[model samples]
Target: MGAARSRILLDNDTGIDDALALAYLAACEHVEIVAVTSSPGNVDAEAVAANNRALLALCGQPAVPVLIGARQPLRVALVTTPETHGPQGVGYATLPAPPGPGEESLDAIDFWIEAARAEPGELIALFTAPLTNFALALRREPRLPWLLGKVVIMGGAFYHQGNTTPTAEWNTHVDPHAAAEVFAAYSAAAEAGLDTEKLPILCSLDTTERFEMRPELLTDLAAAAHCTAPEIVSEADPSGTRSGASNPLVRYLSDALRFYFEFHRDYDQGYIAHVHDFFAAGIAAGTMEHRTRAATVAVETESPLLIGTTVADFRGLWGKAANAHVVSWNDPDAGFAELVDRLGALARQLDPMG
Candidate 1:
């Protein structure tokens, strides 16, 4: 893991998976979380920012700034999936409110634009939310692609079934217009001959869905953390049940993921959770293996039926240059194992008595 050196500027909706991603990043030693920005997706921007602050504090990174961005998606009524991620977007887990003054007043767009410019090519932008904030920032700073070191996005289902609509991913569907704007801006940068290495790594649902989390991972993590009692999360557990693990981190994760498992099972997808954002965060931190193909990616915004559907042309079928390196391969089992090793170690470090 290159967490000792990765400088990450994260933007997320702070849902269940987003919380897990943020917690993982915080656990890594010396990982410079430049800042975290809230965006609207699984929940509203306010709740998202709150979640970020709370998660950071729980992970012992309380000083990390949590900025509030756009409260609504660009050009659409905000649609939140409370049923999917619970009321506050963190499943049934109850996190304490942040303790101190945070980045509530600071504009997330301006903060990112300034950060990217002040430290040109030094910050990695990990966007795991709707593209509304990034799109709005692009309107102010059109050269975002040139300023940031690299980008990793967790949205869009290129070749897989959509979790929101029949043809649309949840993040993209929340704001199709913004997703289109982001891809178009990246395409422009690619046309201007930006380094292919710096091209955005799109961690679309096609690969992320493969990162399905199962109950055994909780057991492994608990064992690694040397918990006193066995930790179990099963499909047979009653709905709305919470974790009573001795370790705080283990308890938080177990309770959070229990809701996700139920969500998937309710949709007939079994008791596993598709932790999409965790893979993106891991890729940005250089802690996970992944493969991507250069593609000219675009979003369908105007069509009523296919809106928010991300279309990728890999064979130069479209005359445009490649804007994103769409992730094509990843190992879910390996990723889960790494999560247990890294996060479980961090948990033990945080609570030695456990």
Candidate 2:
């Protein structure tokens, strides 16, 4: 294959893992992250933007466009669980205080409008947080349908059990309205000849959970944080209890994520906390491949606890038709290794004292 670095716009909520994914993307030689839009999920939107700035700084990348978006879910209140991620997002990384002034002041949708319009049909949008900003962007720019590229989203539990609720995943659960809209757009985009019709590429929780943070990866991460800030949370808690540690950023996000992670693990002992968004970045950056099968992936709009659940079935819907190719299974070990290798490569590129 030839070298094809994608022009990308990443939408995230600045969760700890999301921060990790950003660092990887900043250092990837094959991807050009054009812009970053912040949303509400694991952390608040403004904090999300600040966190993005921090990751960019870590990678020695100068001021990239960090646009703020969707402080709360569309038509719903913001729900952030600190017991999983910690108090402040970076496992409670006490940020040095945000920059004096924020960059380009466009809202999430408008920023998307500008970015996509500037590079019509050539941008790879990576969504790691809730779909709130994306849905709003679609509503704001009807022509977004025409100015699009391949979309790689990191949310939903297609075949695997849910991580946030009985049948819902966090990114989708936070905003089912947006999730529904995004899925509809995905289907419509496929139908409109923008991207592939059977193009439901999912980097589900299954693939993310398989990534065991090998000692080398963790050490690199921890060492990089020495001058920046200490990590409050040590490692994944097997018993599902929030950690009682004291790092600036790590504690906040880890505590919040632990609450969510514990609930999922308690319900299904087979579950491991997935770093969720890493796969989206990898797929968007062209470091991975996903095999798709024709399927009907739907998000539940009215379930009580299972509201944002994504269900994938082998049998296609008769009327709706199997117009999507959702991922049912992934090679866990291989995928995990690739993720680690990429992260390691990024660390070497960004770590200053190395």
Candidate 3:
């Protein structure tokens, strides 16, 4: 059977892996990227929106709308991590100045509202950042639960170690209050018989870590087949090599990724970075295995070192919250093979000479 097509609204913080996953999603055929929203986490919301627009243009999908989301959590000071993401937001990538007035006026929550309401009950809200915007969206318009098909989030730590803090994942810790609200809202929606059973949220530790980017997908990238770093993809071709030259943006993504790779390599011994965001994208693209389980997840906002912690248990404790579907585990080899196959197909299709 062909992959199932689904309407998607992507909310991201636009970090290293985010850029890669966005490129992957833009190349997918089964997923229609209706709107792209930005949230504050790895970088500021405004910076993310600009980067998102640039990436969208590069992927040959510039028409897709880019909306700016929350600058900070609803009731907290914005916390940003430059150690992971460079001070400029995207590592090794230098972005141009803001195109226009920027995304402040519109906000991420409002963007979610319009897009969610526009496709009422038919949209898949794929989140790969702090739940600030998601929580704020729910608060602004509590009715959105009735309008979404699912919410596949790439955040939180269930059993694996957290990336940012001791216990909480980057996204959830940035805004646990918002995360709590989002989780609560979804659970309420499901209990009310809104067909929310189809709503599955793939968190970071449990699902995202399962999918990694294979070296094969890096072949075209290493060859500098198309646009290189700084030079936008819409402006150049990736097929021909210009004698020791590469696209600026491609180079930036590569260098940043390589640095990131080295960081992991030192610890894990030849560890390649996993496409955490891509896991959510894969589910949206209808390629990941997911099932509805009677599981309960909770957000720990009070713990000194364990804030935004996600605890999963089938015992149904902590009020049996609403979590979409967690890809508890996956076959890394098979999953990466499929991911590379799809990526190769997309690269050829996007390349002018292929």
Candidate 4:
């Protein structure tokens, strides 16, 4: 076998987009998923853990460990997006039940602590959920920032229209206290003269929204996967329609994304999906092209009306060092094309006879 290009520790709440992100990562041959820790957002932590394991198994990467993490937000009662991500977070896709909790089960915080300490500066961390689990990990080991090689986060609105609230994004709004703690930890590290190069690359909604998933991409993906029949997701279809795709992977993705498409249509965004996490996943794999701007980032945790709002000081107006490299822009056309090619390669591999 070939050497791994990047080692990643994925922390996500496996909503529809999160499932797509995990599938994209699992499909990539050069990427090594060290572990996955469930965080509450799209669903409860236990359900998120199940989604991660089920998707990984579907993608033929069942060996990757799936750990359980914080079930609720740090300072608030948990809120899940069943309306947006369906009841169990995978939309209409019904995956094989994950094996019962046993040796496969592990604590997220403990894994983060042990893995980082064991191989300092080797693991690249990616957070596509609320920061609850990572913040708890930081509380246990304050030096996690220095121990990890790099970090990539997918949260916050960053001046974009909010998907959850008037001023907040879904992930941050789910657990603003944990989000606050994460940025504060980085700010403290910068003040202490630590190597700030390890500051996370944040994929806020500003640019992520540009990577929309229209129904045509699914048709293209099906063609790439060499499916015997066309896979189509239509907005006019009766609600809760399921895919009858010939390819297993295509069928799974089609079912999941159909729910996402309907959700977006209901919100008046047409039948397109803002696959925010998938873009972040591409950045983590070093495959998708993108640009960034250094900024001092912070999330609001106090104001009742502004809780979970993220503000970025782009010009050092905060008189503090930059805490993150916020993504400024991304090539959505290239992004969509890359996604189709990569995911199609995996689907074709999984069911070659098609």
lDDT of 4 by residue, 253-351 (tens): 899999999999999999989999999998888887888999999989889999999999999987999888999989999888888988999999999
Clash tally for model 2: 35
What tens-digit string does per-residue lDDT give for candidate 3 at 1-354?
A: 257777888889888778877877876777789888888887888788888887777667777778886677866688886656666566556545435544446656777788778777788888888888788778889888777877778877877888777667878888888887877776777777756455555656766766665444455453434534222221122321122224443444554455445445545635467668766677676776655455556678777767778776656555664555556665556555555566555554565452
Could you tell me every candidate's TM-score relative to the true structure? 0.98, 0.80, 0.84, 0.97
Q: Give the least accurate 10-residue stretch of model 1, judged by summed lDDT.
A: 1-10
Worst lDDT 10-window in candidate 2: 244-253
The per-residue C-alpha lDDT of model 1 at residue 299 equals 91
Model 2 lDDT per residue over 268-344, tens place: 64333556676677777877666666655678888676788887655754455443555545554555566545554
Comparing 1 with 2 on lDDT, the higher-scoring candidate is: 1
lDDT of each residue in 144-214, candidate 1, tens digit only = 99999989999898789888889889889999999899999988888898888888899988999999899
Off by over 4 Å in 3: 94-105, 214-217, 220-252, 266-271, 317-323
Q: How accurate is candidate 3 locally (lDDT)?
A: 0.68
User: Where does model 2 exceed 4 Å of error?
Assistant: 1-3, 92-98, 189-200, 212-216, 220-273, 321-323, 339-341, 349-352
Tell me how candidate 1 scores on lDDT: 0.90
The clash count for each model shown is: 0, 35, 22, 0
Q: How do all the candidates rank in terms of TM-score, highest first?
A: 1, 4, 3, 2
